[model samples]
Target: MEPNLILTALFLISAAFTVVTAEYVRPQPRKDLQFPWDPKPSSQPQQVHISLAGDKHMRVTWVTGDRSAPSIVEYGTSSGKYSSVTQGESTSYSYLMYKSGLIHHTIIGPLEHGTVYFYRCGGQGPEFQLKTPAAQFPITFAVAGDLGQTGWTKSTLDHIDRCLYDVHLLPGDLSYADYVQSRWDTFGELVQPLASARPWMVTQGNHEKESIPFFKDGFESYNSRWKMPYEESGSSSNLYYSFEVAGAHIIMLGSYTDYDEDSDQYRWLKADLSKVDRHKTPWLLVLFHVPWYNSNKAHQGEGDSMMAAIEPLLYAASVDIMFAGHVHAYERSKRVNSGKSDTCGAVHITIGDGGNREGLAQRYIHPSPEWSVFREASFGHGELKIVNSTHAFWTWHRNDDDEPVRSDQFWMTSLVSSGCVAERRHELRKILISP
Candidate 1:
């Protein structure tokens, strides 16, 4: 062969090698930041957050270094104006070598919905404000899960703050404290900006279960600090509960707790579903930590047993949507039942990609299942805009984009309005009347 021909052949081989070796590289995971306790007055309130308590009420929770600080909140419609005062209870706990600060939980209001209230915790600290969720349709929910104290978590929270969401729903794995109690305090402070403004309704995840053989039980820290309206919902444990907001019924399930057919959660859920007035609420939703219909390789089949025990109940009730976490990625499934697509079934969405320090679940199972709609391994949050009783919009926002990108979105019709609820009930009646 000629020398020029040999040179051209060698160049072609080099280009081929380069092309084969070039692969799409994902961005590096962000490092976890240590939010140490700043030296301030012992009585000063920190880690201020809020949650829904009951009808027309909000629960204000905060931490104080001083165990004796007053559990009181002063608030009014305007800042620096004293109008209403309420007193609440305070408690503290110890785990291993760590002793937590005084945690105060106060129930404030008969508050007017869609109105902002300025309040001060422990009768001190700078005034903080919170906006109550609207009482009618056209409300929004910011959904994210597995949010740890990392740079990625900050980005997700920042993105959520830009959205005009009425409430925040977390499926689980909140702090990732993993038995280190101080991280819980830091995590609380980290989410204060967002949680203090709007109600943060969350469920328990595996990370929140810091149980030892004999030393401690699971969720001792979590149950004490992050209280939900379990009592009002007739739920025996905080790990699982239900709450209503803005014409919607939201059920937060506990993946870490017993969810068998004979378990307390199962019984409560049955009663709760039976009590739901479709005409009044119009939309029903459920959330938990482990996904029943994930396409990701991580945490595969962890939710099978729970799903087996409860999926039929959800299907019969015609739940509009279900959210789950613990997969460290994002996945959305078509309306599904028993691993098959069904129009009357609930839409399962796995959005565990809220930027935990453990990183994303980057691998997905090949030959994607038919039920899986869209799946991605990116750190981000989701927005659910329930526009009306019948129709709603859902969007997934990716953090890699310079601007908020609607990477995935679709319009969803409520089961009650779509006549699916009636169809499901008829099917259930047929089964009950038959064998």
Candidate 2:
């Protein structure tokens, strides 16, 4: 070795030795920044949430400001202590993830049928848990859409809190993240009261996708700030996924992507519907940010175009009902088959009344459409009550007041028979073919 080279090698080795020794002496933990509201260690858990993956299966998810440690969920009989533990990780292919954000999904299965469970998420020391679930059945869920952080939104959130539903489903368009991060923060604060208590399972909406940083990172603030069952059902992308709660099979779809007949989502959706066993999971519901049968003047006919692409599958597979938020209004359709009233057609509900600056959707976009059952231009959220195999009722809760006016009431008792066909009581599907 040359003398000069030997001298340089010695200096480089010394520098490396110093760095290693310093790091060993005082290694820094991966994260420390905490939400302004959190009182625990800045490194404590956050963005905790849960998703119902099936009748007897529940998925828990949460996030940390720091790179997450091993994710764990401790849960058990609600009101009872969390005695069981479960762990999960994202797949390599799916793990590269939607963007800089890292989302983790953990599925808790073999849950005793019809039982409630309390849970928590995060990592552990001698002990660790992240979220908690209410110890009750017939879980009441507060459903809202297109809610941003305006005065009216605060009013709506406050109103809902007085008599908030069991859980919350802000199907996209949250915080108006499409506008700016400040708005997202304000939006988060508005829902914190309700969200902190129960799971807040969300989907991506057009406005949420409008934020420069949010859209670029696939709603990272939303994705990382809240956990979802994005991977358990093979969605692998929060953009789309499925979960089951009680007698419901909820399929959440992504509308920002191409919904055309020739897209991957179409194929995946076809497969998803095929796999659901009507006997086991019963009620099938689909949710997206855009409507399929909407009749609002602000954004008329936009959703109808999407329906042109996916409605065939929805019809053939017996999708019970569909919910969407976009037009900034509330509308419900009786039932339609081939563009006219049919007893078995899927009921459509539009709940875009979450407090946005635009005010209540007060205009009629369609000129006496056939499927119209009820339409209201009001600022509020929705309450969905799903019971056993035979009954499910929905009510709209005006955010200005806690009163949930029975917006549109229907029965699913003979839904399978009468609801699937005007006259024919069809056999339960084993694998629903997209008829």
Candidate 3:
């Protein structure tokens, strides 16, 4: 053979060797016997979960490495076949150094009032799921905060794993993504076990404030991977939205915004609260990333900074209850004037023990402050069951030593009914107002 022919033959042999080696390194698994929880790489989704959209909507968010396929949600009356299909786009998150798998999401529109919908989410590509209840009116859900990636998180999840709530409300500080991106995966995996059965609603937290590259992508991977109910309720943005669930008007506030009473958020809150007549949605529950009445030293009065701008609106509108997270521990308050009086004020609960890296909060306002009605430095999670419009059962499960137990619990009652306050101005709602 000529010299050029010999060279071509050598090149072909090397190419064949490279191809064989690559195939051996990335062997394909048998489709019939694949495990969903096996950390091994595959086209299957791991963090499969859902978030309730107020009353009649559900947002499904998941992740997959391959983007060649669509984000499809197959649904019907049962889990056998997905007769209904909704497709979404899959996008990747660009980190400071590398890129991860594509995140997919699908938001189902207004579902029936109390129907059980069996469904699985993933594109025509990969999927998994169990039957779940659609959003319903007057449904009871558990609101938790400060959940991160930790052993306590595992226990908390296991404890809550039995509660089988209709929804999981995360006020903030989800995966503690402020420092690293890996924890986000841990948060995702554990939550999949429960959120797949129910919806896991969320608001932004300080931890999600990563560098420009991360934020520029809109926390691209995180936001794209999860779906929220923004459009259905006429919410201008996902960061802020209001949905009607059961007999309550739920508004999710984003504190990381310009909350100067004159800002856009303040105006929108006012408008939203003003229309919440006691008849339409009898109870008004407002949730945000931070707390307004926490007594912990780290975030003492941190929420006070925005009270002047946002408090008056929520107070004026008589938001029935306010839930938040930021501090690492759990704290409840005495129903004061602004939050003290019986006729008005929302019952504030700071149940941040959802599981995080921080151990616990040991300081209070006074030498230890009197504002903290109850505080504990244990690994735990909170469960809120709305018994009715006037009452809710708040229970905290302390997952100490990885053993789940009901550490502290209480009954949170609301006096924001029509018979209590006559108008926008009430003394109880005024007591806590900055004097």
Candidate 4:
């Protein structure tokens, strides 16, 4: 054979060896852990969780069996000492044969940033404590999505609990109740240990749309149960909202909601982006359910329409990162826009593998695309630590690892700080202020 032919043959042999040597971890057994409903005192609070209300307030949400339990929260900086009290409201919904318990939402704060506060809900049950996120940089957000009540979810939550994350950002698909209302209760109970300690900011997913024709509307349970500060951000619907934390302006978009150019979410997003002051909060991040760019064969093209409608606005704002869920795998794209890598574009990350009942999305399109920097099919979560105004770090942690392993990680520089979007910023400002 000629020298060139011999070289080609050697290359083929090496490729074959590499393929054969690649290690594969099969999907774990799917087990949906069930919480038995045992009767407790009517006033005892269960399914407790907390979310950031605004810059200073934290919303404490929980359920009580008593229909008339007071919607009140007593909290203070010291444990078991009630220094302040705030009253919110209570609501309940009925879905088919299921009537929910009295769900209480109480906003208790004007809290001290980075301070631990202990509180009791409905003035009963075990005391829960939460640590407020710092008002500056060096904050951590634990990003996970599609977190159903499964064995894998427990593992993921356990791993997250070990991390000193200031807040938790679930892109969407929280309980995976799939219209089974009881699962939401169990999910809240399962996550209470961690969620009550840190703020869990989330958006909505397709599974949350439990709409019944001519009878019940979608998101009835989700809206009432997980009430975000949509109103605070000038959003009409709870499905989409934005919140600021520790020098990061995090926008949570709704994938299942109306996202057309004229839709409320779009208009709200446009207005919200326009008001973002990069000089104050240098890290601008967005999270939603469906990924705009994915190499996985599953759920391909699902986000194309949404991308077409709103991606330009995101690009114009120079969004530093875009987090998404619902594909049941992990994929990180290079800073990309309209299917091409661009320095000014956002680094899109899909971390839907939060141990949902549905198994991993293992099949991916052959010969990965240019923008997909790293792709894997595994149950895992991601941690994004914004260390300063200009720099941040991201890491993906797989559930199967015996010890915490940074399977994928890299330091990211803010687009604004890097001066990549200076020209676009001027143009965006003109568009925002123009008639």
Worst 10 residues of 4 by lDDT: 12-21
Cα displacement (Å) at residue 412, model 1: 0.8
Per-candidate TM equals 0.92, 0.73, 0.81, 0.93
lDDT of 4 by residue, 305-334 (tens): 999988988888889999999898899999
Question: Between the candidate structures 2 and 3, which one is better when assessed by TM-score?
Answer: 3
lDDT of 3 by residue, 369-416 (tens): 444566655556777766666776777776655666676677765555
**Local error of candidate 4 at residue 209 (angstroms):** 0.5
The lDDT per prediction is 0.88, 0.61, 0.64, 0.88
The better candidate by lDDT, 2 or 4, is: 4
Q: Give the lDDT ranking, best first.
A: 1, 4, 3, 2
On a 0 to 100 scale, what is the lDDT of residue 220 in model 3?
A: 47
The 10-residue segment of model 1 with minimum total lDDT is 13-22
Name the TM-score of candidate 1.
0.92
